[model samples]
Target: MAEDRSEQEPARRPGGRTARVRHRILEAAAELIARDGIGGLRYDQVAELAEVNKTSVYRNWPDRTALVADALATFSADVAPLRDSGDIDADLVDFLEAIAAALSSRQGRALLNVVGAAHDNPDLRAVVDDAIAQRLATLSQRIKAAIETGELPAVDSHLLVEMLSGPVHLLVSRGTRELTRADAQRITSIVLAGVRATAAQHTIALAGEHDGGKTPAARP
Candidate 1:
């Protein structure tokens, strides 16, 4: 009953089979966590859900925490912006929508379950903290890079990430209405408006300093 994907992989190569197997295990873990929370996640259950042997699960993951960490890491990677699309407006809209979709997906629910459990378990909390830190660091770098290229205004990257993601997280994490692509677009528009306004203010302030604190006269 093991779901050996060797034959199902697009490539008949060894690497293809390995990739397929890894995806299956990660997906199985994500689904189990979504359905039953972290307490219900066990190697046996993971093996059953993945349709693989328990030994196979152990051979690949080696530990429970390791499996959970890898699964969450994969989810985070999916949500991160790997490249800029040259159009800031379109790019930001797509970026936020991708985040909304990821966090609301079954895999995202599974990730949140692990996070919720970490609240009381110090050891588990440490592991989850490390995993999240890794996720955030990667994302923060991209935000910083945008600022450097003048695509974004100078602002706290972490704070910007929080502001960008908080609303969607609140609604979805609280079991409220799911965030839609339209909603994501609107949210990005608002945030960008604020950022542009702030950048303009900064420009005005610098101009005032250059002009000995006098307002420049408007051209007729």
Candidate 2:
């Protein structure tokens, strides 16, 4: 069944009719990729799903690999970056919750499937890497913004995002644990504390520098 289109319309491509045609191809590709694993993806299936002719698929993608690459890009675009809502704690919490929700979605699972398939296919791996790179860039920017505002500590933002999400990935991928609300809270607390502690340490060090690195006299 064709999924219900969201109220928000996709932006029009500069190519007018050709743009709509390409968008339909991409939409069809996303649906097929979600339904079938990356290895099972076929341009013919995409054409059938998009309700377009095979010639259109060929003209747009030229090959199965190109089709897969474009499909993965389309899928990546759907997973928008984590936003900064000004409240660092709330933002991080929301981000974690969103991760859980996304991982449970068909599209999210399909992303992992593509990752696995990319392991053997070099070209596909590049496509997957590019998608992941885009996500990581978004995450890194949010982390940096938080740090700049003193909402988070001075740290490697990329590493910090990974640290925050490492457990969530393990939980979903390993099936060792479920991402309960409580778990999300606990993860947020731990990360917040770590960031705060590091920031505090840095502040104390800077204060000491102003005091000429001298130890204060013992209090009575």
Top candidate (lDDT): 1
In order, candidate lDDTs are 0.75, 0.71
TM-score of 1: 0.72
* Candidate 1 residue lDDT tens string, 88-127: 6676667667666777788778877888998887766876
- Model 2 TM-score, all chains together: 0.72
TM-score for all predictions?
Answer: 0.72, 0.72
Could you give candidate 2's per-residue lDDT for residues 1-220 as a string of tens digits?
A: 2222221236453456566667778777766666677767787777787766767777657877777777667556655557778887767777777777666565565666777778888988888777766655666788889889977778888778888877776677655666887787888889878777776777777777899878453332
What local lDDT score does residue 128 receive in model 1, on the 0 to 100 scale?
A: 66
- Model 2 misplaced stretches (Cα beyond 4 Å): 1-17, 79-85, 172-181, 198-220
Candidate 1 wrong stretches, greater than 4 Å: 1-23, 58-62, 79-83, 121-142, 206-212, 216-220
Clashes of each: 0, 0
